[model samples]
Target: MSDVAEPAPSLARLGYSERWKALFAPMADDDFVPGRVMRIDRGIATVGTGAAVVAAEPAAHLVKTTGIGSRFAVGDWVALAMPETHERAIIEAILPRTSAFVRRQPGERETGQVVAANTDTIFIVQALAPRGPNLRRLERELVIAWDGGATPVVVLTKADLVSAADADAMREAVGAIAHGVDIQVVSGHTGQNISALRSYAEDDATIALFGASGVGKSTLVNRLVGADVQATREIRDSDGRGRHATVVREMIFLPDSGVIIDTPGMRALALWDADDGVSAAFPDIEEFAHACQFRDCTHTAEPGCAVLAAAETGELTDERLDSYQRLRKELEVSSARQNDKLRAEKKREDKIFSKAARRYWQSHPGQGGRD
Candidate 1:
């Protein structure tokens, strides 16, 4: 294997097409250049301009950043201020994204972190562990991916560990829940179906990887890239859980075509603004709701509620309906909390403005006679 991976793709090949060209054309200020965010680490961003992937900091105004969720994501197209000297470039502006994979900040109400932006497709990588894929978790991931406006494909890794029959059984289970989506079972180590994963990103498309820790995202990334760009660890023998290997979300330019954003496994994936995603992911439930007696049926015990009827009659599995209800209820509670946060912020701002206004009027008592 080559110690060095292939060089990064050109800006155009990095999905910097005419749309980006038009967006950056307006801000054609001297010394300002277009760049894509490769990765962000410790207050510094690795931005890949056409020329080079340089260490960059956000323009002073954009700096008060916290984590990956607060600022530029892995796939953001940005405008950078590159000076003549050896100083790091400045990310002046983040161009509008075609799609954004946003999740609620874990343990925080009313805050969102965009996992990746402008991804044409998102590979929901779930390892086929000895216990099998977690159906409920897969459902939640589908909701977020559907809501993010990216084509979601389920890639089950570690096929070599399980028998063919077991892998087939697991794939069928996943297929049942992952309705209307492409599903692939592959061994990243053995290179089984790796080419199929590559086919999704043809013609300079961008793909984002999302999954929980110990799912072999890092191993798959290294295999897909055909280089040891990311680290890998073995799963625990006792509990069958793999250790976390990837730390920062990094973007790599594929030698074959397009770019891939490899992200660290998430411990928690709370929903942000995924109401539409819920409907999209659960089309069958939505279809049943449309035929219900009342428009706002919660699918619980509502009389003539088609969803409940379906669940009772074995048309829809009880477990699946429960998952759907849980997600809906979670979204409802999250939405309320987010609204409350927004209201409190507005009130605080208003109080501050009122105090400033009162002080100005008191200080300039005679000068306030505009009438």
Candidate 2:
């Protein structure tokens, strides 16, 4: 007789939806077990297998080959291998991710970093206190989120600190920038309009909160969990910047709904590879591009360029167009570098194969003797 083991409580509690079931179908025949990564630090990660959360390390082969890109993050769905010894768990593979939030790390290194994976929605939180709201920063965040394959929702926190009229005005201003995306005003201190935000927390869904420092992201997270899971800190009065409140990216599962991943607030948001997002965020510019005389109009000095014409006529702000162009140029440069690396790799592989073929011929001279 075969032994039937009890299913993990956490996976059962999360409920097996058709979508998740489909996602798991590919792994059912494999020897690995499925789990959701809850936290990651150094080179290790804690994954929840519905039964229990366990600390694990990526298989040595995977790590020695690809470095950190293939390693686990907070929200990745990974496959685990349990050895006879219970102490050391091995993450053999990662399930295909539906969505991932990636950004360029702000440093001298020129590499993109994956902030969170498999997020269904991203709450781009911004504060209405102290210096009011930063529309430019919000616009940049929206572009990145949209490019990351997640729906972006603008959350204006700290409603209690601002006057009702001021809050309404801020909402309107944000609405103008967001276009059709949803915007919610909530007070983390007073617990206002949190119910509206709860709808996105449906079963099997995952949401991530991202924004600048002192934006009340941690406070909002505490309200949602119904406990102070995250620490709250005040912004410095002089510079209007706050200390890093949430240091690590961690996933917290809601009681009846889904999970939320909270990460430390970011200071610099450099564009990575968000051309599609730029187009979607600035639809007006995209629309004008279609009317250009040449199909591939650079829109800089080309004749009959509708985009540049729109900027000259004040239909589109030059500053907005400039920002769009700057991002596009960055994407082009990054793509070129990536393509060059790929070509170089292909050339090296070809050379190695030719060398191997020559060596094989030399070893078996009787099979095909030289003239």
| RMSD of every prediction | 3.9, 4.4
Error of 1 at 141 (Å): 1.0
Instruction: Give the number of colliding residue pairs in candidate 2.
Output: 1
Clashing pairs in 2: 11-50
Candidate 2 minimal-lDDT segment of 10 residues: 1-10
**Could you say which candidate leads in lDDT?**
1
- Residue lDDT tens for model 1, 198-279: 8978989999999987787878888888999887765466564556678888887777788899998897999887999999
lDDT (C-alpha, whole model) for all candidates: 0.85, 0.79
Compute the lDDT of residue 53 as modeled in candidate 2: 67
Query: Scored by Cα lDDT, where does model 2 land?
Result: 0.79
lDDT of 2 by residue, 1-371 (tens): 11112333476444335666677777768666777787787767877777666778888777776533575777887778867565657887776667777777678234567788889899999988877779888888888888888899999998998999999999998886786699999989999999888888886578899998778888888899899888877645556564687788988767677888999899888777777888778777889999999998878899999999999999888877886787778778877776787798899999999889788889988787452
All candidates: TM-score: 0.89, 0.85
Question: Where's the lowest-lDDT run of ten residues in candidate 1?
Answer: 1-10
Clashes of 1: 0
